[model samples]
Target: MSVEVVIPNATPGTGEGPHWDDSTRSLVFVDITQKNVFRWDSVTGSLQKVHLEDEVGCVVPCKKGGFLVAVGRTIFHLEWSSQKLTKLHEIPLKGVGNRFNDGKCDPAGRFWIGTMGKVLSFEPLTFDMEKGELYCLDVDGSFHKRLDKMTICNGLAWSSDHKTMYFIESIPGQIMAFDYDVTSGNICNRRTVVNFGEFDPTDPENLGIPDGMTIDTNDNIWVAFYGTGQVICFNPQTGKMLRKIEIPCKRTTSCCFGGENLDELYVTTAQAGSTEEEREAFPASGSVFRVTGLGVKGHPANVFNGNF
Candidate 1:
């Protein structure tokens, strides 16, 4: 597959959470460490960025206009034109050293987001054992907890029928499936759907760290694996990997479907945590990439309901 660089330097650190805003016909994403939220127009080839004070985890477009931004435990309402930010709701973690990570809007218009622990130790190689929690911001502006005890909550997707929800926790090395209720936006009957246990464990480069994912019309989950340098397509129902598209960068962060027909897959990558040699080997480490000719389209991103 021929990969094209959409943004030469998307971010300095942690380029993640790409969301396609159908309203504005632009692709929006964030650079966590840089505290930058970016928007791009593929047709016009224009790029715009908004700088926030804290680490920006993700940005999703709201139906009522503007955007819902998850940054440092607080989700804010952002007006890209005026560069104004208003506090929407905060994800509570108490004394735990955790912050929000990857998230998206459910089909019912509720904003579903999750968090990760901040503290990490290399002596014995440990991250915050505080656990990851998934939270949903309801249409009436109330926040509720949905899932718990995950590490580095990452990608999210729902089936075309809206009866299934696919989620990932970076450390678990798998994509989990849950019975989803579209009306109430609830999930239950959790089970492993696409565990990467089959991947070669001896290779450090292929550690199956599932990061971000999107679903196709045929119910195929295309997931980006961090440290693996590839995005893979898996059939959750069949428990099999259908295909893998290799990437140039080592840290493949997240991906979303967009473009005119929604067939173009936009992928984000990071260079922040890579070794010097790895960064040197892949010069376009932090760039945004685009892949086409997959012959499958993804669902339109759900718009956030900011009515509350």
Candidate 2:
């Protein structure tokens, strides 16, 4: 089946991060280029926008009627009522190019977030400023250690059993897995789970880098390709690409399993850095899309406890 772009011409430039909020039964996404947070309900057909001062990276649901949000450099605990946000906690960062990119909470309600370098006008994509790192913050006001040296980190996900952790280093086209100790929140045994280069010999550079990811019940990982026009599904065990859901957009930013049965695949796309002539090529560039009959029921979203 083909994936349909729901919000046609929704965002202007970079419409990046998306998170499915089960509590409100709607999808929350952000336009990094516009610095706007949007909540769109498929059931009621209502769309709302919360304009923020700084660029927003990721937004996950919280336990006590709030959300955990990552702005440019700090992670904040926010309470949203009447579409207004109140700050709770702020986690600081060190790198200039570094900003929070992709994130999600594990089974235990700990938010796992990654940082990436800024796209400078002059510099090409290279490992700069210890660009990416993984961090964990528990619900008990406990701060865990950070994973170091990864550049352009994206696509954070966990296996069905929560024993395996999967992540992607976007530009280099590397997908890695770690032996996750859930109890201690420590990751070990870093090994390559999926490498994108070997899969496609033709036009690897322009095919796009991996962005946001989600896990199916069978432990399959669905990754949105940044420059490529497809969402690739990989078997976690073998790192083999089983399916590719082709989208008609240039920049497929992120995807998640939504809908009542959690079978519908909701995807977010971007028109971030496109030129005038290039924009004419893809009209629905920065839009949200959905596909059904995937047969994967995703886990409900984790809510961050207000006290955390």
Candidate 3:
């Protein structure tokens, strides 16, 4: 396998979500703190970006048209061509400082998104804990709360069979599995599939916090470790590490499979809150990378089927 920089210094802040747009044959991602949405076309080798008014957690293509985006506490429909945004739904977080974080669409076309306590600061990083919740926005413009009391809700993915849903909660450093009903968009039977707490904290390899994730065709969970500079593949059934791909930067935020065959792994990193020593160690900290020859393909990204 080979790894190379695709977009060097993509963002100064955190580059969180990475989604492959099959229709456009491009990769779509977001820079949370920067409030920017970006699209990089594979065919033309061109990049497009749009700055939003609020922090953007994730962006997914809509089945009908345009794109579905999670911005701050609200969901918006973005017309990329004209840069028009229409507010869809907003979570009612009265006095709580919570905003949407990482999210994606399930196979059945429901937009599943989660929120985290508002980021107080990046440098010397600080945020409230256990103030997040997960919700599913159905096709008919209905919303359902799936889970709550989450701290830093991050990566989300579904099993190939669509019976299991996987999620990541960064603070506890655990990957959770849920029994999923694709027909009803319900998730239950929550259990831990992988726990970083089981590893020795003193070990350098174990220092990374679990962050964004994706799954291969075989249903193996590939998770990006925030501080470890590695993306590790784990067998969900056995909860065992299968392989580890090292990144050039420490704050490896998220990854997704792109390319025409979905064989290339596109990774996103962050340079926000980096110290001088770390900046020198990883000069390309905020770049997006593409890994080829992994010998595994991913399922095409699911688009939101919502009418709005």
Query: What does the lDDT read for residue 183 in candidate 2?
Result: 76
Question: Worst 10-residue stretch by lDDT in candidate 2?
Answer: 121-130
lDDT of each: 0.85, 0.76, 0.90
By the lDDT metric, which is better: model 2 or model 3? 3
- List the candidate 3 regions with Cα displacement exceeding 4 Å: 94-96, 121-125, 198-202
Work out the TM-score per prediction.
0.94, 0.91, 0.96
List model 1 lDDT by residue over 1-308, tens digit each: 56889898788798999998776679999999899999998768899999999888899998888899988989899998999988877766644568888999988998899888773742222468647889998898888998787777889999988899999877757788999998988889999886764345357656557889999889999999877788999899987889898889978889999987899899999877667888789999999999988889998999887575
lDDT of 2 by residue, 79-184 (tens): 5555556554454656665677788888777888887776664212344555777777777767664677777778888887779889888767888999987776
Worst 10 residues of 1 by lDDT: 118-127
TM-score of decoy 1: 0.94
| Clash numbers, per candidate | 0, 4, 0
Model 3 pairs in collision: none
**Model 2, residue 190: displacement in angstroms?**
1.0
Question: Candidate 3 lDDT, tens digit per residue, 17-68?
Answer: 9999988899999999899999999898898999999989999999999999
Work out how many backbone clashes candidate 3 has: 0
